[model samples]
Target: MAATIDELIALVEQNRDAVVGDLFPVREAAPRLIEASVYHPVICLILQGSKETTSHAGSVRLGRGDMLVVSHDTPVTARITGVPYLALILPIDLERVRTLEQSLTSADAGQAASVLQATVAGSAILETLARLLAIRPKTPEDSVLTPLLLTELHFHLLRSPAGAMLRRLVSPSSHESRIARVAALIRRDYARVHRLADLAREAGMGQSAFHHHFKAVTGTTPLQFQKDIRLSEALRLLEQGAVSVTEAGLSVGYESPAQFSRDFSRRFGRPPRRVLQGIAAE
Candidate 1:
């Protein structure tokens, strides 16, 4: 089991742009897990059994050979329902997304890539990804040899049955692509006072269309997304011991320090000050 876990870690390291490590080998039967929330995007790929994730909007389940992509910054509750269920989670940085986007766009596939991107994805893409992720690459790996794995994943998507859904992510002309761009802006400057009209303008869509398109892609309203970014940033700042509660709150676009405190407490189950103190006192 340890060897298998180690190998899987190595594979993820080779394929990942950036990731956070909190890995272990364990078996459990529903022992009250803590809520998980992150400031960036994470992909949870389940290898055995299943896990259910609940956001403010709705819940999603990822069974074996299935994955869930959390693209927004938000607080979420996760519960392990299936017995002895396990998953491999990888945090995908925006830099990685940009790299893939550029690679696909610059390729000379021309109309073939366009047709793939326009079609909705089916199960072929998921199956190929699942098989690749199941590998545990053990031994001295080439650091600069990652392009093949990345490109293979691209090709798999281009040819998969679910290729359309996967291709939706790459369509620079599609609504999904525009919303993705908006998401990138918010991620880069989460502290900005984001107005719906401003986001609509940036998305190059009308106000109503922007709202509809944004929610269609991210499954949340604009205000909810912003609030999530603020909270996630506040958590990271406190965790890193770089700022005081007041400073963290304001830096993440919180105007009223009191309101920030309240929201932080509500989302995190503790006030920012107390959480910082706990983290420091540890």
Candidate 2:
């Protein structure tokens, strides 16, 4: 297993410009605090070092041989706790997973209450990823064989225990799927005001049931989730120096600048003005 991982790591390092569309290689040589960013559905495999990511769903640490599965769009703060971090991030295609799920038999029922799960990567998944990384981009193998390998990869994932999150996400009748849909909607139009009742109706649940399942899956309430999205976007705007603190606040749906400052400070541990100033100094 170690040899396979080492070879895969070398392949990623050698093929930095390879155009495998869904496979992204990450090699961070130094530990640093990665700012808040939205994490879409993906499987992240750590080939070397370790890191911790905290989102509304809580903090999780992953190291070598570990696989992290995220089933929704989560805004998170990530910190590299170990140097020479190397990983492969493969974005999941929901439509593909859904289509595959309908054909596979007795897929793991999955822990339907959580949006994030971490476990050791199975030998099958690791080897499949190695084959995927070995493909030369812009070649016939990449075009003809990439899709087949990805399907095989997804099949192995569906058959594994760690795949429970992916399984639950693709199950249209599952409560987690309903809440996931709502969460994706919130992320898309985060700048607009959303009513709890409207969100509940959209999820096909009563307000109380929707709220309960939402918090259970997301580790935060619906309104707080929206606020997380708003503040994350505000930080991006301030960091880019394209807007004033006040403008950033209003642009992301804050009615009052003071409230935005307070929320931004609470979320990121710095005032919006301070972020803007730091960007200007740079």
Q: How well is each residue in 113-135 modelled by candidate 1, as lDDT tens digits?
A: 11101122235444434345443
lDDT tens digits, residue span 1-282, model 2: 523778878888889746585888788889999776888888899989999988877788999988888888888888999978988898888888887876666764734435677888888988888888888888999989999999888888777766776787777978889999999999999998999999999999999999999998888999999999899888888888999988999999999999999999999898889997898788
Query: Candidate 2: which stretches are off by over 4 Å?
Result: 1-3, 110-113
| Over 4 Å off, model 1 | 1-36, 39-43, 48-50, 70-86, 89-145, 157-164, 280-282
The lDDT per prediction is 0.60, 0.85
Which of the numbered candidates is closest to the native, going by highest TM-score? 2
Clash count, candidate 1: 9
TM-score of each: 0.65, 0.95
What's the distance in Å from true for residue 216, model 2?
0.9
